[model samples]
Target chain A: MKLRTAFFLNTNKMKFITLIVIITFNTILHSQSQTGLVQYGHKQSMGMGAPIGIDYNANLIFDNENSLYTFAKDSLEGGHIRESVYIEKDKDNFFVNSKITNKLGFQYYVDKENKKLLSRDIGFNYVKEEIPTINWEISDEKKDIGSFECLKASTEFRGRTYTAWFTTSIPLPYGPWKLQGLPGLILEAYDTNKEIYFYFKSIKYPMDSKIKIQKPNSESENKEWITFSEYKKTLINKHKKAIENGRMLIEGFDSADTAEDKYTMGNSYIEIFDNE
Target chain B: MKKILFILLCSFVSFGFTNERIEPISENESAEITLPVKVETYNFPYENGTITLTIFDNGICEQGTVTGTLSTHCDDDGIADYVWSGTICREHIDALIMQFNASC
Candidate 1:
């Protein structure tokens, strides 16, 4: 075909052949999607003293076109931060992770074909926006976790610097929580200060149940979806109200107290940036 | 119902229920919330949520813990919400009030 000139070839026939090839390629890519379930143990530290944090489970079910990160249950008990230490704080204390991700009926869904993300925030606020870009710098460093060889990559999202360990063995971009757009499956991820961390616990790849990608809808949660920025503004207003109310509620939690300066919106949220 | 409310309101006005949030003395960090009355006044730097250490006009001390993010102010709920664990105690009830006022 390259040797022959455009005039020598039948132009109508050539265009038809090209269209067939394009359709075939798209069909092959779509057929190659492997649906599976991944379980991740999430740990978020409440950095008042030593390493004390809340631990919980986040499950991700993904195939080709969509991925949904969901949680089975929520815990308020002082979770194990490391091997021994646990959040001795009252079970009622709202941990940062749950506050950001798992509010009421917290369902995080990603539509890859259209490139959009949908999630729920506190106060029954919904978030549906274009998928934000995560510029990950993959390093040459590699290690073995379980049986698969994992590679290291780092990216700064929201406000915290996160390091992720992914394995191409799975060959999917889905991970625990909101971390996605990777070339492979992210098995583990942690922030720079070790305040937040996620690691692979177990998996049931190629799940038996037919994987159906369903967006969080009114049938489940009766609410209208808003942009991510609007959802954040609501939280900012709540925190500001809390600050104002704090002055009248407790005597010590003021400008001079440790809880005042450190307890800003930036530090309290999983997504540190309010604009997101 | 109105009669009981009137009496309660009158009693509260007469007693001047003063609520404060403070930590216990250095010697009593993990002490039980209910201690013997002879200890005078004690504070609890609540471990998990907001707490209230209230002293009535007659010098009876009572502490209450309420669990909620909104309760952190310890304001309307009369609870103290400071995740920070520090209980600096000034033993005497009257003296604790003076020291608390001076520092704030």
Candidate 2:
């Protein structure tokens, strides 16, 4: 036989090249064990606050204890854009406060070295825009959430269509407010009209050891970055005259006589930019 | 021997189809919850009084003790007083009173 049929055709071409290198290393170890792990959950309820108030322009306040305030008028009026209320107390600790306005010729910049709180109009020095740079796209399907195991990713920056879900199993990649760079940690995100969702409510990992990380001063830093539709078209063209004078100050406003004269006030503003 | 017993039964059926096993809790399952308890009344424009409290558990506010005049305009003229007790856990007090009645 011609050398045993050329040694059985070279062992069937080395067993078809070892079954294509073990099926391409088992499809890259099954997509790296399905993207490792790091999925969390959270979606509490109780919100009625944030209803019109952005000190400087945009107004419409109705009060009876059903609060609704907003403020950040025109290109988010000189830095330190105000409108605070974070209150997280179980998966860590939190506290934020700032909703007092009406002092005129403003000039407040309390950047506890970037904790943020800037205001200016007393002598004007405005001109600081930049905030737009987010990109992601990791899909191939996989879901579980609530014991971890997620994937579905997306990104269309500035004009909306976020939709994130990351994981890698509890590897801490933070989320809830300023979304983070994924690889593992975005628990959940929304946009396509869920209005704005962000879920992933708990994670402690802090046994008797201080771990602080807060820094953002110098007008709460931001030399560049934009898109969220260029900060919502720079907040509707710099608060289109404070949203037309806060819809003419709530035209004939009378939220139940300011909720029975419990003294209610309102304001609104939204101007953010850094890039589109 | 029959081709080495068919290559050890095809390597134990390809290692039992690549080790498939996932449990995710299930010991004859059992879990239920329902919570809700409310009695609102808050108006403390910095302390001149009126806070009939009662929002227990999760963001707890129990019969919080405090009464009258603490002025800063009594919390900007909204009146200032307090009184709330506690006992929530009916599925987190009906999900915080359906997220404070927004019927979440």
Whole-model lDDT values for every prediction: 0.55, 0.33
Q: Candidate 2 lDDT, tens digit per residue, B19-75?
A: 322224556775332233222222222134221212221243232221110001101
The per-candidate TM-score of the B chain, in the order shown, comes to 0.17, 0.17
Best by TM-score: 1
Q: Worst ten-residue run, lDDT, model 1 chain A?
A: A76-85
Best-performing candidate as measured by lDDT: 1
lDDT of 2 by residue, A102-122 (tens): 222222222222233233321
Candidate 2 Cα misplacement greater than 4 A, ranges = A16-18, A32-178, A188-197, A201-234, A249-251, A254-276, B1-104
Question: The CA-based lDDT of model 1 is what?
Answer: 0.55
Model 1 residue A32 lDDT score: 46
Worst 10 residues of 2 chain A by lDDT: A59-68
Residue A37 in candidate 1, Cα distance off native in Å: 0.4
For residues A133-209, write the lDDT of model 1, one tens digit per residue. 89999999998866779999999997778899999998888777788878998888888766677878877776666
True lDDT of residue A86, candidate 1: 23
